[model samples]
Every structure is written in structure tokens, then in C-alpha cells.
Target: MSRIPTAELSRYLLAGQLTRNGCLYSQIPRIPPARQLRRPSTGQTRTLNTQSDPTTTPTTPQNAPTPAITPLRKQLKDQAKAAKASGKKKKKKNVDNQTVPGWDLTVGIEIHAQLNTARKLFSPAASSVNDKPNSHVALFDVAMPGSQPLFQPETLIPAVRAALALGCNIQPVSRFDRKHYFHWDQPSGYQITQYYHPFARDGCISLQARDGIAAEDGEGVEIGIQQVQMEQDTAKTMAQPGGVHWLDFNRVGLPLVEIITRPQIHHPATAVALVRKVQMLLRSVDACVLGMEAGGLRADINVSVRRTGAEGLGTRTEIKNLSSFKAVEDAIIAERDRQIAVLEAGGVVAGETRGWSLGSTETRRLRGKEGEVDYRYMPDPDLAPVVIGEDLVARLASSLGMLPDAEVDQLIDEYGLSAKDAISLTTIDNGSRIEYFYRVLDALEQQLGIKADIESTDDAKQRRALIAANWCLHELGKLVETAPGVETAALSGDAETLVPSAALATILAHLHSRRITTKVAKELFWRAFRREISADTVTTAIDDDGLWFKELSQDEYAALADEVVQGEEKVLGEFARFKQGKAKAYPQGKLMFLVGKMMRQGGDQRMDPAEAERVLRARIEEVHLSGLGE
Candidate 1:
């Protein structure tokens, strides 16, 4: 690890770049794709993949095929079947008898989230992860023989806010301890973590049981939080299979908050939901990004199974550093079933730490799980206890803007949106998304001449808000997904980035009143979102694109309908069938496309789209009544 260059770490991490060796090095507060930049001091993780060596890797420029996916349950069943056919009767029965009924599945999780601060906990080396490995490292980070550890109070402020958000009690005085461990990444020989006394305790997360492993995003059930403590991160260790491991000390000495939950979560769905909610809430406070796969945030899960009403806990195994929420859920379910299988076959479960392989849908032993006594932890003699005064805690607490849950409630109560819609709008785990949502809503109301402070008695305001919300959630959401490079910055809460408020308001106003078709609105929106158009460009887009509300009279509609039917006889027979009472499909799908074509006939979007359609339908009925076709 020490042999690796510091520049390599900073480059790959801060740039979020794919390294030469194909390892995953992510920088916290990921910079824009347009600019070469690193975050102020954020998190980065080392995800090494030996198979990604480009030298040995075969290249297919296009059409890279994907492997077939087998369901995890199917995979497990197949494994059991294979064992049975091989005359491994004992192991076969153990695997085959792994039913989950009546067995209590208990899970507890320990999550470490990197604080979004500007400097290291003890040094000023820009705490960010850079592509340059040692670029962010201070002398103290590498254990310069004469360097001493210093405390940073700024780090504690976020720690307390994170705890407050989690409903934990903040302690006035918290002590640091030296946790002795030997890992290639820990250049100092021991990690500075909270062992005996932590900053906050007695926290709880309330949620509801989700439906299944595939649909675990819903909130459910109440889970008790044990504690959230502050700690310093160790350096990153990039390993080469059966070879030397590379170390990047840039991550060393960064502040991290470890949120530990109780073993009361017996449902896989609950565990997944809790972790996701934690990520959302923490980000709301701008505490940590949780960087899951990128290393800003990760969870260590403890899994055990016992009799439904058992008096004692079953032997448990720990899966270390399961980053993705999906991985967390799948690991717990797989491990729980495995424990059930072993216990049913009268084999004892091993108390070990395991590593999850996403490709194989299984877990393998990493080492025997370590307990508190194994570390021989002691108070750090060099550092003194961190003291938090009431004034500081109060100021920090009062400064915390609306948390995620509060925002969710506000969306539901004020806007009259359903809980499902409200959660979807806010739970995307991106702070910029929610910020943009309300900003556009406010702009829409102002464009409609409603004051920001006054609640309009007109239901029209609510209707407009719904339209804006729908557009923001659906159309804008798709834009971000499909063209994230263009739309990400604007949606990322940079007011000056692109897509000014006035243009958004104009588009939403036109859309809400059915003055323009959704297609027309989207065409103009992309211009704004990509910054190709400036403020108040919606009007120009509408005028230049020949898009305007045209209320067609019955005769005008009849003329266009006649032209369309004569030009294309495709739907004439269908229209005849509607008159013959053989079918009641008057709202023909083909007619809608024909109507759109007639409205766009002159290379212009002209018409109150809904009214034009209604008039066109009436004209068709008139043709049936006035004997024009019959």
C-alpha cells in the first residue's frame, strides 16, 4: 500500500475515473463531468477488481453481452440439488432443508459515513480523495515519526447534527480510544475510533416492513438505534490477487460517523429500508453522501436465526462492508437461510466474517468474526476528551435545515400529494432533486401571479402545482437519466447552471392549461435544460416553433378531419365500425395520432390540444350523423 503513488488515489477518486487497473476509486462530492476537480473534503473508497485488468481483458468495442441472471433462490436450490446428486448427503440435506418459517431472523447493521468537511480531522490536506494518491495526505496521515494527532471541532459539529437527525442524545464529553488492529491500510498500526465512550446514544429509526426483497423501498417498522459515534477513517488498500496491495493514505484521518443499529430487525425488507432511509436522512443534513458503492458510506451487517420464540440468540455471522443496499438485503437473506440450513441439519453455524460475491449470489468466509475483547482497545494517551458546549450544540442543531422526513410530510400536507408520490419526489437520495422541485413550483405560482407567502384560495394554484410536480418527476426525471451529463448540473441545485426559473414556469403554465402538447413542452424544456436557451425562452420557443393554443371551430375541425381521412384511409373502416354498433371503440388510438399530425401539419404546434381533439371527435360523429360518409 505504501509503495503506491498518492497521485493515483487522488486522480481516480476525485475524478471518479476508471483507473488503469479498473479498480473503483470514487471521490466524495463528485465533480462535474465538464471540469477536472475534486471535492472539498469528502469520502472515497477502494473497490479492487483483479479481473478488470485491461491488459489481459478481451475488448469488444460494441455489443458487449451480459451474463444470464439466475434468481438467488433458484441458485440456492440448484446448489442443494448439485450437492445431493454428488452423494454429499449431509450437506445436501442441510442446504435442501433451509426453510425460513418459524426461524427468527435477527439483523443489526453498523454503517460508517464520511463527513462532508473541507479538511482532514487532524490536518489541512484538503480531506478530499484525489486521483493523485498521496495528494491529500498530510505528514501525520503517513505516520511521520514526529507527527502528533490533533482534534478538529468542525468534524464534531456534523457528527452531532447526524446524531440529532437520527434521534440520538449528544454527550457533553466523549473520549477517543486507540483500537489496535493490523491491516495494510492502517499505516499508523491502529485506527482512532470510538470504543468505550461515543458521542451519541439511544437513537431510533422508525420504518415499516417492505413487501419483498425486490420491493424493499417502502418505509416500515420501528428499529432501535444503538449509537452513533465519531471516528477517523483508515487509508484505502487496493489489493492485487495473491500480490502486493496498494495503499492510498488520502482517506486516512478523514472524519466518519458510525451509526450502529440494534439487532431487532428480523425482516430483510426492514433492514434494506432502514439503510436507505439512513442514507436519505443523512444527505438531507448534508452530513455525508453515504457514497455506498463509491465508499462514502458502507454497512457491516450481523445476521442470525433462532427459534421463533427462542430465549437466546442463534450463532451469527458478519458480512463486512456490504456497500449497496441491494447487497445488504441479499446478504442477510442468503446468510439467514444458510444458518437455518445448517441448524436444521444439526451442524453448528460458524461465527465468522464473510464476503459477498454479487456475481455468484453467495458469501464466503473472510475470517473469524472479531469481538471487542479481540482488539484490546485502550484510551488514546496523546488525545484528550472532546468537549461539546451547549451553545455550540444548540447553534448547530438550530441550523439544520428540514430533514428528509419533514420535507416528505410538507410535500404531502401542503401540496395534497399522496404519500407514495411525496416519497418518490423526495426519496431519490439526491438533494438537488428536491431543491429543484420546489424551486420550479415556486416559479410556476409566481408566474401565475400568486404571491409566495399567501396561500391561494383558487384551486388552480394546487392544480398547477400538481402539473409541475408531475412534469418534474416524470419528464425531467427521464431527462436526467437519459442525458445526465447535460441535465445533471442544473438539477444539481446550481441556480446559475441552466434552465432558468422563468422558462420552467412558462412551460409549466402552458402545460397546466393544456395550451400545448406534452411533446411541444418537452421539446422546449430540453433547450432550457441544456442551457441552449436563456431566461424567458419559452415564449420564443413557442413562437418560433409555431406552437400556440388553437381552438378549432367545428367546421375547421371537420375540414382537417376530412383532409386526414382522405389522405390516409387506414382508420376509415374503424370509423365505419364505430357507427355500425359492432364495436364501441370510438376513442380510437389511431385517431389521436392523426389529430396530432393535423395539428402539426404546417410544421407548427397550433391548438389547445385537448379542445382540438374534442372538436375532431365531434366532427367525426357529425360525419356519421349528417350522411357525409354514409
Candidate 2:
């Protein structure tokens, strides 16, 4: 190769028009001030290469004419026109089948519930909430350097019980993967979750109409669970005004179970029912806290709308972080209508994530929907695959108690309680009321001086069970929940003090033996609930033959009825005047007047009004006939 002098090569490379005009070194590409070069034609634009001679101009054959070059401006306009046409075609295609008079809504949910455990899933740090901010964080929780996750075996115990309760097929071997994302709440820029292999799958919850959380019809419905996997929770991010956010690390690294459901829900009610059923199952198995209002449970609802008889599903939108059943219901309805409206307006619904406010009726877009590729899921290198043995699962299953539905059925079939009564008994406080129900039954049997078998078909025992259920649910539940002037603390304390089951059984026994009316028994119930009457007083009153309540037997009522008719001369005269006044209809008002006098004769309100009226009429007839004979 020939080498040029350093000074000459530098002068040629650094030469400019300004250098030449100023009589100094300048760039070499110099042209006249007013002259310019035209852009090369599309067909004449040559590819730069070392094999081609720069001085030669290539020519086409005479037989083939030169191709016309399109203008740059016109080409841009054509491209925009084609893009617009393509977008219009897509919009029309989406709207064509979606614009119908009636629309059907389909919904699915993904719920994340904080597992009930003492410690974090992968760290030894204690798990708690509403404590000092960032207090629960550990080295691995914040993803410090050289820190690795150590899986806690205790978490799998409750998780297995929950899976068994929900009728899930527990996997023998499950693995964790790292889902990569960038967010302020994620310290590691990735979340450890069960993606390709979850701990459990293919579970279902049976919702009964009697529970009032199922379908509108009488039959029951089952919500199918697609999968339930364990994952670490994200930190709490509180957004403030002016786009500022505060992060609380205490929530980060908490153990959670992400439950994904299949899209079988066709109505908002069904969706709410499904969530409640799952919550009940979790609570029954002591798996998750599920205090949805307190951030222990969060659900993401996927909703879509399609025209009736449509072949496939339409575009779906997800409403994230719904913490209540009302929010779940309202968000689903609002998003369904929104998609239907967009399709009916000759527009396309964008696939995106959305958020819902508690009182708002609509959903706001959070972001465009992210596909699986966007998450960049890969197996976690540091974590080992979780291996659950059959022995462990069997042990957990054996420890499980009877779930709420079975308890309800037992209350109905064995105890002879109504369906509504049985469900109410088992639904409150995770079947605490039902436990009280059994206590009341045992107490009632002991008070009545008999030991009744629950499985026996004795009418007396069935009657007693029904009576006890009514008192527990209608009277006790009402007073505990809404009774005025009742101390809340007293109601929450030991059941023996808060209207002892033994005393309540005494009141029920009086009502069952026809010694007192339901109204009188209710009065005694409140007195007992308020501690105005003790269990000793209740037993003493029974021993003294209704000293406290003044309950009248059938013979006592008959005697009182006759005495009032014969003793009240003014009342008898009033009846006689009414009978002789040529009135065709019977004087029910006068009869009630005599019955009232009989009720007030003993200065007590314990007399049965029906019995008083019946006996008083017979005595009045006997007196009138004797008067005619005289």
C-alpha cells in the first residue's frame, strides 16, 4: 500500500469550505454558496462497495425504460393512508360480531391471600401487619447481596390443609420460578413464584343456594379452581398527591397463595359467591387470614363481554386489587358494560389492566395487558424444588376438621333445624355460633332431666333442637350484633357469662312446657342476657312455680277468666247492653274488653291472650243463659 505524507493527509481530511474561504485549512467538500445537490432517485441510489468505480455512471438497456421515482412526501402520505385503512379494517372486524342487542358477561378471578403463618415464607423474620413500617424486613427480604431464600416448611402445612379442604389435587413435586419485573415494591426486580408447577391444582368449591351465596336458582353451583401456588408478597406502596409514593417493606416477602380460577362465572353474584366460598374454605382450614378489608386478601377480576350466541370470547379487561366482595361484584358489572359499550359504538376494546375504587361504578385503565413474555419467567437458580411426600399430606388431611358445609348439613338433618337456620348457625365467625348451638342443645337436655340422642328420631328432641336454634340465632345473635345498651366487650367474652347456655335452656324449657308464651320467654331472655336474672334465679323461679314471671297454667287461666266475668259487674252490664242493641255481628270489641280485664286481673302480663279470650267467652255465655232462666 502507498502511504501519504502525514501533513498532506491531515490537510485533505480536515479541509472545509470555511478554511478555503478564509485562506486557511478547511473541509474538502466545498461548493458554491447558492448551489445544492438533489437527492438521488430511488432507482439510481447505488450500494456503496469497494468493487465499484466511483467515476462511472451505470446505464440501463435501451429496451427497458427508466423507472419512475416516487416523491418522498407522496410516499409518506400513501403509507399513512394504508395504515389508516388497516386500522379501520381491524376495528370493523371487532365490532361486527360484538354489536348485538344483548350481551353476555364472563368473569374469572385471581386472588392472593396472605397465608396464616408466624414467619415469612423464605426468611426467619416474623410476619405481621400494622406494625412499625419496614420492621418485618430481613436480609433476604430486601434482597441484600449474598443473601438467599430458605424455604419455610411450616407454610406448606396450612397450605396443604387448605388444598385438601378445597378438594385440590396436591402435586408431589412443585418448583419455583423468578418472574422478572421492575417496580419500587420489588427489591430484587423479580418475584419467586410457582409458575410452570404449582403446589396444587384442579380444586373446586361447592356453593349452595341455601347459603345465599350461590346462584339465583335453587340448585348449587361449583366454582372450579385452576391452580393455587405460593408466592412472596410485594411491599405496600401508598401513592400520594403529586406522584409521590411511600413504600413499607414490612409487607414485602410475606407468604401468599395465589389462587387462579377458571372463567365459569356468568354473573356478578356468581363471582361474589365464588370469592366468599374460597374465603370460607381458607378460614376453615386456617390457611389464610382473608381479612379482605384489611389487605389480607386481594383479587384481580378478568371480565369480558360477548354478544349472545357469539362463537368466541371478546376482549377482556382485568380489574386489579379489589379488596371487598362489593368491589368485586360492581367492578365486574361495570367493566362488562364498558366493553359492551365500546364494541357497540363501532370501536375496539383495548386489552389492558384496570383499577376500581370502592364507591365508583367504573374501572380506570392501569396499564396495557402484559403477556407471559413480558414477565420473563425463569427458574430460580438458588431455590430448590419443593418435594411433598404422601405421608405428610395424609397426616395433614387427618388433622383437618369438618368444614362449614358439613356442619350445616349436620345441623339440618340431625338437629332438625331449617335450612336457613342451619346455614345461619354455621356461617358466622367460622362456625362459632354452631358450636354454641351444640352447647345449647346439651344444656337443654340436661335441664329437662333427660339425655337425648342427637341421631335419634324423637319428636321431642327435634322440637327442642328447633327451639334452641331459634333462641340462639334470632334472639342471641340479634342482641349480640345490634342490641342497644349491651356492652360489646361482655358479648365477646366467655359464653357462660354472656347469657349462659344453661340459663337460656331453662327459659326454653319453660316455653316448651307451655308455662310461658314466646313473648314472656323473650322478656326473660333479655333479663338473663343483661344479668338481671342469674341461673340460680332461673332455677329458683321454676322451683317456686313462676314466682318471677307469674306464668299461668291452663286451669289457672280458666279460673281467672271466670272470676273476671263474674266479678266485673260493670263489664258484664256493658256486654249485656251491646247484645240487646239489635247488633247482627258479634261484639268482638266487647269480648276483647272482658279479655283485657282478665289479663290485668292479677297485675301481671303473663296470661295467654287466646286462652283468656276462649275461657271468657264460655263464662259469658253461661251467665247470659242463667240470666234468661231467671
Candidate 3:
């Protein structure tokens, strides 16, 4: 089959030889003919073939030739059939048996993100939550008749910073275009967005798979980013009883970084993971709070499942307003299943947009593909191009602080911590707590004049590192977890009265040096933190109370130890019995109960579990006891 070039097809359409009915013609008249042409020699004779000869055939005039189109018509029909067949084959291949039949699903996503800034993008309106709706709206945001659209410099910096952090390329010049759409929530019929040149483009994000642990296999898959643009949020929609809706303009004009991802994501699980990773990165840079419950961020998921070797994507339907990560995941799976079922039932899934109903956990189509409304997009003449200079980028980079990913990597490499531990520690949001924890480590090393060789640490250094890590993870983490949602700065201020870094260092140093037992160290740590006493003061108090060296009196200690030995006799007998051939039923609960009683009787002083176990084992061996009857 032969194909006509696009240029020739366009020319045919322009010349009116082809009509919308799909017809082709050799010649078309320019205008209505006024009269027929007549031969000069014969005034009333009809034009016919002339110059007939014995050996030569008569010639037909060019303009007066017969209009025989059977050959041309056959050629056109053959070409059309070939094109149609080719198209059908391509479609069939796209819908081949590679996929599970019966389902027809499509997806689209709209992300509503809270811009990382202190103020609204267009107005001097304080970007705070407590501000009144109308009060927060600047003159421009309220669409004051003569007011010009103004861009907030502060807002742009964070937006750009977030874009760069996401590995996006910042366009040198990006303009805000007006997307005209109507809603009561949108006081202005148009929204300012970068439909043409967005702030960031061609980026990627790596998402962890559903595995409980980080896979040993290199990093996770990279989801290709489509574009990240700055846009103003519409007003909050409040649904009231009786089918009425309320609009709160306070949310309007709030800067948002709308990050769109390509539909390249295949698996529903991967989609969930990608959203999580994106949320993590946004939080790491302090770009978004990512409070799914608070409506701080939302995702619009686009999903389309096609058969293997498909020439193009299947009909894509967008699931909008997936506020929670769980919802995003559930919606994708649901849509995929729905699509497969439709296909299997010999029904076509229409390309359209849908909204996820959290209550029903089903997607309802809002509009079909052809029904999509044109959001007339044009450059906003009132606003100029956003110019991003190198200085601004540098400033933003510096202000964004250390991202969590980089911090996690540092913790793993520098502290030799496990990936899980690093993720946990780096996820700590209390900035002051993080700073204080580091400060304590610094003071400990300074006071002891100990240089930690993390790579080749001897026994002493390893012990110190372990102590530091344990204290941070167990003791400090417990405190932070129990504390209310207050910044670490407040806690640090209270540190002077509570356990200061100096005091913590002193106690940890003692623990690291093995001068105090684990029980003693824990007690001292609690006391120091509770009383907010200095190390010297805590040490002196312990000494003055004879709590530090009271155990040095072997006779008294031995007596207390003997009491524990007698009390845990049953446990000791069980240990011996387990060693023998006869194995009787032993309850770990009962053993722990006896251990607790012994520790309590000794005032938790003479013998901790470790010491008690050691003593019990030795005494049990010495006695050579037989098995206790069940």
C-alpha cells in the first residue's frame, strides 16, 4: 500500500478536492462557469478528438477530456482499506492477551500542594492559618479592579528550592499563564499557572517497594516526573447538609507547587511508594508539611492499564483528590481491577476523569474524554516572567538546610548506623532535639578528649559509640516521644534545669568506662534528667549518699547476692534440669517473676539481671542439682 505525504494531504484539503466525507477528486472548479467554450473553426460544433490519421490515433484536448474516475476511485479505496487495516492491527496488538481480561480502567491525578512559604504568593496576606479568609486575600487576590498581579519573591524561592531538591531543572524564564475555569471558590475565573514553561521539568523520584526493609538490590525504581509548576490554590470547599456547599477564600491565592508525574508508572504498588517518597522529600526540605489529614497535600492519580505490546496507552482515567497515601494505593488497584473487568466483558473503558469517593472507595466518572472542557490558557499580560538568578538559587539551597536523604546517608556512613536506625533518627522532626542530641555527643567527646575512630574503633571507642547511640535511641527518643508537639528549642531552654549536655556526658562517660553497671547508669541518667543537675553535682550526690561505692563492701554485697541466689533457686534448678536428659516444662514468665522479686528485694542495687544470672549459673554448677519434678 502507498501513503501520501502529510504535506500533500494538507494541500488536498486546502484545495477543496477532498471533503470532510473522505472523498478524493482529480480537479475541482474554482468558481461557477458562465458559459461553455466553443471551437474557433466550428462556431456550433462540440469539442472532440482531432488530428485523426491512418497510422496515428487522434489526440484529446487536455481541458475537454472525459471525467472517468473509476481507476482513481479504486486506487483511493485500496489505500483507505490498507490504512484502516494497519490501524486495526495496531489496536489489536495493544489490546493483546498479555493483560488480564474483563477490566477497563483509566486514571488521572491532580496534586494540591501547600507552597513552602511564609506568605501568600500574590498578596501581602500572611500565609498563616489563623488569618481570616477575606483578610488574608490581598487586593490582587480578591481581583480588585485596578490592582496588578504581583509575585511574591519569598514564595518563589521555596517553590524553586523544592523543585531543585526534587532533581528538576529550573527553567530560566517561566511565565504565569491564566487558566480560565469557573467555580464559586475561585473568585477569579482564571488561575495563574505555568502551562507552557514550568519551574521544573524532566525530574525523577525513587520510591521504595512494599518490602518491610530496604531491599539490598540497589535503589528502587525511578518514577519520571512530568512537570512542577507554581499555582494558586482555590478556596476551600465546605460541604454542608442538604447538598449545599460553602466557600472559604482563605485558601485561595495560597501558593502551591503542583508536581505532575508521567503515566509511566505501571504497578499500583509502585504508585503508592512513589507518592510516599515524594512526600518524604517534600517534608525533608520543609517544603510541605504533608499532613494528609489536614488537607495540606493531595494527589490526583492517573492510571491506565494496557495489554502487552500496546502501541499507545489505553484509555486513561484520572482519580482526583487522593488525600492519603493509602487512598492513592487503593484507588489505583480498584481502577486497575475495574478496567480489567470492563475489557473482559466486551465493554470499552471510556477515557475520562473521575473522582475517588473515599466513603465508597469507588471511582465515579465525572466527564468523558471528548467532554473535557477547554481551560483557555494564555499568558497573563499583567505579570512578567519570573527571573531566577544564580544568587537566588544559592540562597535557596543554603536556606533549605540539610535534606533528610543527605542526612540519612551521612548518619549511615559516618556513624555506621543501620539503614533503619538512620531513617528513624533522620525522620525526627523536633529540630531542637536533634541539635541537643548532637551537642551532647560533642560535649561528651570534648570532656573525655576522646577522638572516635569510627572506621577502626578499638574496644573503648566502640563502647563509647555504642553508648552514644543507645542513649540517643532509647533514652532521648523515649523523652521526645512522650513530649508534646513542642519545638526542641523549648526543651533545650529547659535543659539548664533538666539533664544538660554536660551532665548527660558525665553519666554516659561513666557508663562507657564501665565504672557503673547498666542499672546504676540508668538510675543516674533518670535522676540527672529529672533534677536538671550538672554531672559534678550528680556525682557528688551519689558519692555523698554512698550509692556509688556501697557495693564495694563484699560482705554486705555477698549477703544480698546469697539472698537472690536462694530466691531464684527454682530458676537455677530448671537450668540444671534443662542440661540433664529429663526436660520438664519451664515457664519463662515464672522465671522473670522470680528475677523481678530478687531485684526488688535487693533494692535493685546488689544484683541486676545480668549479675544475678552469672551468680545463679555458678552456684547451680557448684551445687550439681538434679532436675526438679514437673
Which model, 1 or 2, shows the larger lDDT? 2
When 1 and 2 are scored with TM-score, the better candidate is 1
lDDT (tens digit, per residue) of candidate 2 on 468-489: 9888878876766776765654
Model 1 quality (TM-score): 0.73
lDDT of 2 at 147: 78
Model 1 has an lDDT value of 0.73
Q: Model 2: clashing residue pairs? A: 15-26, 15-27, 15-28, 16-26, 16-27
Which 10 consecutive positions of candidate 1 have the poorest summed lDDT?
A: 28-37
**Index of the highest-lDDT prediction:** 2
After superposition, candidate 3 runs with Cα above 4 Å error:
1-111, 208-219, 241-244, 308-311, 357-360, 367-373, 394-401, 430-433, 447-510, 513-604, 607-630
> After superposing candidate 2, which stretches have Cα over 4 Å from the reference?
1-101, 213-218, 238-244, 452-457, 481-497, 500-503, 506-524, 527-537, 540-605, 608-630
Candidate 2, number of clashes: 5
- What's the lDDT for residue 390 in model 3? 78
lDDT over C-alpha atoms for residue 133 of model 3: 35
- Tens-place lDDT per residue, model 1, 241-260, is 33335667888999999999
Ordered list by lDDT, greatest first: 2, 1, 3
**CA RMSD of all predictions:** 11.7, 19.5, 22.5
Task: For candidate 2, give the lDDT of residue 409.
Answer: 84
- In terms of lDDT, model 2 sits at 0.75
Q: lDDT for model 3, please.
A: 0.64
Please give the CA lDDT of all the candidate structures: 0.73, 0.75, 0.64
